[model samples]
Target: MELIQKVLDQPVAVSQPASLRPYNSKLKVHDQILCGKIMHSNFSKLAYSIMQSVGYVHDIRAVLFEYMLL
Candidate 1:
């Protein structure tokens, strides 16, 4: 939880366009779409884990109610 909180609290990091390009390669844009998808999957798992840890609310109905309250 502390690590996740620390990550959330930190300022977003940006990379220079030049640095984002692959070494000696010719892709115009960085693969940000793929990166975003991967991050989304990992974050979803972390959030589910946290939710499970906080309470014995593993049912879909309870999860939805809790999420709605938030």
Candidate 2:
């Protein structure tokens, strides 16, 4: 509960386009898309682990929906 509350209290971190740097300065469009997919997958796994640890695995959808309402 404390961990969840702490996460909820923190403001969202939004990154600007200028702040993003590709792994390879010469990265192609395909590479950029691949990088984005990998990052999304990693974040999803991390979020699932956190919810599982907090015993909210079963209520994940409901929790996210309520949070979005806020």
Question: Against the true structure, whose TM-score is highest?
Answer: 2
As for candidate 2, its clashing pairs are: none
Please write out the lDDT profile of model 1 over residues 1-70, one tens digit for every residue. Answer: 7878754444332234536544332221212211233234454444444444555323432344345348
Model 1 weakest 10-residue run by lDDT: 25-34
Q: Give Cα distance to truth, residue 32, candidate 1, Å.
A: 3.4
Q: What tens digits encode model 2's per-residue C-alpha lDDT throughout 1-70?
A: 7765654444332122422644233332222322344244444444545654567644563444355349
- Candidate 2, number of clashes: 0
Q: Estimate the TM-score for candidate 2.
A: 0.31
Residue 9 lDDT in candidate 1: 47
lDDT of 2 at 53: 55
Deviation of model 2 at 25, angstroms: 43
The Cα error of candidate 2 at residue 43, in Å, is 1.1
- The reply for model 2, stretches above 4 Å from the true place, is 1-40, 62-70
